[model samples]
Target: MLRLLKVLILLPITAILVVFAVSNRQSAVVSLWPLPYEIATPVFFLVLAPLILGVLLGGAAAWLAGGKSRRLARERARQIRTLEKAATTLPAVLS
Candidate 1:
């Protein structure tokens, strides 16, 4: 069931990508200044590279932004464990 759903979703996307790649096969020159480096690549690749990079950077940024919340949750769990241990030991010490 899940496999069928995945296939259904991916089939159209794959077809679209194939069409895009086929239509945009022209070569494009990419140059980086101050380094005297130039690369010639397909238009499809030129378009896709930046998109992939943006997605990766955006995901990394989001993960880093959530670090504080994750750390706080871990600290909260540790505090709860310490409190539970003290509560269990308190009655014995009192008696």
Candidate 2:
């Protein structure tokens, strides 16, 4: 069922991308400042590159932002384990 849903969603998107790439097959020149070399690529690639880059960067940023919360969760789990160990040892030591 999940696979069917994925196929339903992805099929149309893939078709659209193929159409877009075919329609925008013109060459585009990308120039970088302070560099002597420039890249000549397809218009579809020029349109898609920044979008892919943005998604990657945004994912990285979100992962980095979650680091603190993840760390806190680990620390909390460690504290709970330590407390459990201490509690388990207490009765033996007392007896």
Candidate 3:
């Protein structure tokens, strides 16, 4: 089911990207203003670089934002383990 969903979503996007890349085959000059750096590349590359970068950066930001939540969950899990251990020992001691 998950594989089907992935295929459904990715197929159209892959098709669209293929079409875009083919349509934009012309060399585009990408220049960094201020310093002398330039490269001639395809237009799709220019679009995808920032896109991939944004995805990576956004993922990092989300992970960083969830740090506290992750820590709390870990502490809760440890607490649950300790309580369970205590409960087990209490029953043995009562017997």
Count the clashes in each prediction.
0, 0, 0
On residues 1-95, what C-alpha lDDT tens digit does candidate 2 reach at each position? 99999999989988998899999999989888699889999999987888789989999999999999999999999999999999999999999
Judged by TM-score, which candidate is best?
3
> lDDT of all the models against the reference?
0.95, 0.95, 0.93
- The regions of model 1 sitting more than 4 angstroms off are 1-15, 33-37, 87-95
8 Cα displacement, candidate 3 (Å): 3.0
Q: Candidates 2 and 3: which is better by lDDT?
A: 2
Error of 2 at 20 (Å): 3.0
Instruction: At residue 21, give the lDDT of candidate 1.
Output: 89
Per-residue lDDT over 31-86 for candidate 1, one digit per residue giving the tens place of the 0 to 100 score: 99788999999999987789779989999999999999999999999999999999
Deviation in angstroms for 14 in model 3?
3.1
Ranking by TM-score: 3, 2, 1
What does candidate 1 score on TM?
0.62
User: Model 2: runs farther than 4 Å from truth?
Assistant: 1-15, 31-38
Question: Candidate 1, clashing residue pairs?
Answer: none
- Predicted structure 1: lDDT: 0.95
